[model samples]
Target: MPQVFKDFAILFKYRNFLELCFAVLVSMLGFGLIIPLLPIYAREMGASGVYLGLLTSLFGMTRSITSIPGGVLADKIGRKKMMVGGLAVYTVVMFLFGVSTHLYHLLILRACQGAASGVVWPVAATAVADIVDPKDRGKAMGFFSMMWDAGIAVGPVLGGLAAAAFSMAAPFFVCSALSLASALLILKRVKETHKKSEEKPTVSLEGLSFHKLSLIGICVTGFTVSFAMGVVHPILPLFGNEVIGLNEASIGIIFGAMGVTRFLVKPISGALADNIGKKRVIVTGLAFNGVFTTLISFSESFTTIMLPSVARAVGLGMTMPSINALVTSMTTKEKRGRVMGIFSTSRNTGLVMGPLLGGFAFDALSVRAPFFICGFVVFMGALVLIATVTEVENENAEIALS
Candidate 1:
């Protein structure tokens, strides 16, 4: 209620948070600009279903491999530097994607993109955790997620139109420009937030404490949810274009609607997580997502699909911020980057496998098979959360920019 608004108000008081939001928004805009068209573009280059899946999985593979190491660098070296370097890489990769004439070029570029993401996304998340009070972490993360989703929502529409009006490569060129802008913005405006840890930076899995168990639980949940989404990612555009006969612009609009729904839901969900139980919010939202995702498999047309698509967005909006807030609550500032990196690595590992599974299912099974399997997996993730995660109320003093 009023308390949520107050917490949100408190977030705006921090310059670092605002700067980070702006940078992320623009960068994600760049992401949105080309990602929806990527599958179709690959297909145009003579890729088959399994090959397209590999193309998507390759990005996840490189990102998964790099995420833990990137996090350690962020912890030991600095968050801002890691972010800046990653964005610079992203800018270069996006530009290269524009000029790429073959599928192999895309594969190389995707690997680079994944590596950059491994550095940028976790470090940026760690920075978000670092800048806010634990009490306000949920709302801040919601806001952060919302900003990027906003960029994603608009990007597809513009990209679709760009592809229609000019060329498929047009949107990618724009993406590169936006990525460059984002990198400069971060380098200039964002401050260093990592407090030099007295202990050496290292990741381990040997602990039996409540906090450690909870971290493991959240990681499992993150992996499951991301796996579900990953299963849908490579095939969703193909389904829309091939089955429903939607043009690129039309497909863009559908994804845009989904993104908009997620963008709107995140801040509210974050606030609710702060007030109601985080686990309660997470389980409920995930259940909603799981049901709707299953329903999407039954869709026969664009009209039938849109409802479930938006509903799925609502579930994701609720789940991600709460998950992030919970993770932030579990760690101290000194180790936050590495911990976020671990979570990202876990999620990316799922991403690595999901598309492969999805591609196999799509190629070998019914067209609806991937969606059904993904839906079941998502529902199971909700149950896993209920069984495993125990919410700990963080009582640490809030860190601030001096």
Candidate 2:
């Protein structure tokens, strides 16, 4: 117990890392509060299956388009500036999301929110990479992952209870307030990490350079996982309510279960990746994600649903840290923001397509169909990763010592 406390003390010694964790925690908590309820809110506004999917896709599309620019700007301008500006926009947009009365209102607000998100996440991730050593990158990312998921795990349950006790709009109000608080926290507590430089970094796209191939594999893996998530996101609440006959609180509990499992698994998985090999952990995780996502289609009740949700969480927990660490390990500090931006763009590309296709699948076929397609797509992505990616061995050891 003393050793554990000492380890934590050492980890938190990086003040910027601690502050960034707080920022992510509050920001993600706000976002998480709305996750389970958003589809239901759209449904109440008379959105059909297709419209619901469009709402999510539009947000992703906007984020995807802006991510690269946001990354470049973070490198050029400053990470702290982008994060503060983005959070302010996010807070206002989330407030407006509560006031929206029509599907079109949601469409516009969600797109704005996505743009804001593009600025915040990639920049924040780059900032995290800035603070930690390459050897400790996996552990730092894991702790950061834990904080975000912990907030997500707790937020849904609270949001659901608030919605049930007051009104659907109540949770949105809470989300907006928390977002505002997070923005303020970032403004006051976080320091600028990116050193402003006049020279622009050039990223080459030619040949099968080890860096290029690893990046490609990471991006593809990101797309596949997010695609699966996007399909499930808009559909799951409705599925729970309509099929399982669950209430708002119950649906929140189900979503919370996944977050909880992710929170529990990330640290261990991250350590394993750091100690063993990133490729091994990433491949195994992707396999699990693909399998369990398919299994979700077969679930008929709340108890059964938790099985897949927990399994999917394990996969995410394993995949995210390794992917993040790999990306960080490959890039120089000067180019980290732009590279991570491209990384975000790749994941958002899946986010863009997943819902649009999932929506059509739900409307044209059945609720279960999207899950099957998502699973198959992710499995293929895993195969691509296996074929393309090789672990960075000696280079990482050198970085750790440096």
Against the true structure, whose lDDT is highest? 1
Clashes per candidate (backbone, < 3 Å):
0, 0
Query: How many angstroms is residue 368 displaced in model 2 relative to the true structure, after the best TM-score fit?
Result: 0.8
Residues 1-402, model 2: lDDT tens digits: 653334455357676898898889998898889999999999999998889889999888999988888888888888998999999998899899888888888999999999998899888988998888777777778878887898889888888998999989888888999999998998998889878857565444432123678778788878887887788779988888887788999989988888898887877777778888888888889889889988988889888877897898899889888888887776667777778888888899888899988889988999889889888988888888898777665355444533
CA lDDT, candidate 2, residue 289:
87
Candidates' TM-scores?
A: 0.96, 0.95
Give candidate 1's error at residue 367 in angstroms. 1.2
- lDDT score, candidate 1, position 268: 88
lDDT of 1 by residue, 150-187 (tens): 99999998999999999999999999999999999999
Error of 2 at 387 (Å): 0.7
Instruction: State the lDDT at 184 in candidate 1.
Output: 97
For model 1, the superposed segments whose C-alpha errors exceed 4 Å read: 1-8, 206-210, 396-402
